[model samples]
Target: MSAPIPVKVHYHKQARELELIYENGERHRLSVEYLRVFSPSAEVRGHGPDSATLQVGKKHVGLANITPAGRYALKLHFDDGHDSGLYSWDYLWWLIEHREANWADYLDRLEAAGASREPLGIEIKQL
Candidate 1:
């Protein structure tokens, strides 16, 4: 099975959503926060096994830009200054297919680490 080509890619700033339409007739809508935390960059995925970094405080991260990387992938720039990951077509398809399970795993990890998705400075103290 060949990878599906993206027919349309639209970023909705206000909603912080990246909408993708594929030639195979599949449409995937992903949140900016999800994309940030799951970035395929070395900073997030790391250079080696057991070195992956957990991204936190990105619940409100927004899309700044999206640039095509040759004919295979896309470079996503985030409002929080992250612009390294190159999201490939295959990767994107995988993301869309496994979003729910992946998100659940992320939440579980965050809970295990006592991490909050809320940005640091704006966090409210719960006394």
Candidate 2:
């Protein structure tokens, strides 16, 4: 297979947006909400198959900062303080390329399961 043409990644913390500028000079904007819900952290992506941890309420989350990892990948620091997963060039590229389709599928999963992206982890208080 041919190698990727190499792309440039840019993060705007205030806007909670990430962009990938491809070799072809095309740029793609990736939203913070999308990155959070699809976080690659161990907290979200488990060690093994079927061990995936589904994230909720991340639709409004955004990037806190970005750390460079060598020259082929990035260490994404989410506003939620998650920085475990290292997003490789291929993975990030794939995400940027397929963001729309994947996000739609995620929403569909929630709807089909009668689930929501709202918080389910809030502590309840006794009346």
Best by lDDT: 1
Q: In model 1, state the lDDT of residue 37.
A: 94
TM-scores for all candidates? 0.91, 0.78
What tens-digit string does per-residue lDDT give for candidate 1 at 1-127?
7568799999988899999997778788999999999999999999986899988899988877799999999999888889998999899888988999999999998999999898888644222
Highest TM-score, which number?
Answer: 1
- lDDT of model 1, residue 22: 77
Predict model 2's lDDT versus the native: 0.74
How many clashing pairs in candidate 1? Answer: 0
> What lDDT tens digits, residue by residue, belong to model 2 across residues 4-120?
635667887667788878788888778877777777777887887588776666655667678878977778877666778887777777787788898998898778777877656
RMSD of each predicted structure: 4.5, 5.0
Q: In order, what lDDT does every prediction score?
A: 0.89, 0.74
Off by over 4 Å in 2: 2-7, 118-127
